[model samples]
Target: LGLASCKNNTETLGSPLPLNKNYFENYLNARYNEEADYDPNSPANILREVHGLNKQGKLITQVSMFANRYPSEDALKLFGANEGVGAQLPQ
Candidate 1:
């Protein structure tokens, strides 16, 4: 969401960490349309309610949550991004 969430020099506004912009847009649009039409759990619900908050530009909001969801380093680095949003940051 901001510089605070960007620890990787390779990640930035221009470089979006290889996320699907279409899914991201759909995810953002889903926030406004909450119903069976946007069920996050559905694989192909036409619209998703909440797949990965990262797809909605709110990864920062789910930073801690993702950590618990993905505790392993390799796991977190994969689907769950650290982006300096875990439990540490340079003071």
Candidate 2:
């Protein structure tokens, strides 16, 4: 995430882009403790996971992940609980 200067500044910062190079290969190297993907094929599960991940607690982590250009969260918010670690930092 080092600063770089290019003659062209047409590209917007933070625009969602695909990882098209090896440079980003290690970005998720420290990302661990992924929350369970409850039911990959179930629409209900997909919605639930999205809903859970967008809750305030999880949203904080999501924000950091994007802002910092990496998975910065150290823990996962419980699916439906108020407070508890559902998972831990990447190992």
Question: Candidate 1 — which residues are off by over 4 angstroms?
Answer: 1-14, 31-91
By lDDT, the best candidate is 2
TM-score of 1: 0.21
Q: Least lDDT summed over 10 consecutive residues: which range in candidate 1?
A: 55-64
TM-score of each: 0.21, 0.15
Which parts of model 2 have CA positions greater than 4 angstroms off? 1-38, 53-91
lDDT of 2 at 66: 39
Q: Where is the poorest 10-residue window by lDDT in model 2?
A: 55-64
Task: Summarize candidate 1's per-residue lDDT along 1-91 as a digit string, tens digits.
Answer: 5555645455343433534555446555543222222343445432333443332211222221222222344433434244544333345
Deviation in angstroms for 56 in model 1? 36
Top TM-score model: 1
Q: Residue by residue across 23-74, what tens digits does model 2's lDDT show?
A: 3555554353444333454666567678785322221222213334432231
Q: Candidate 1, residue 88: CA error in Å? A: 18
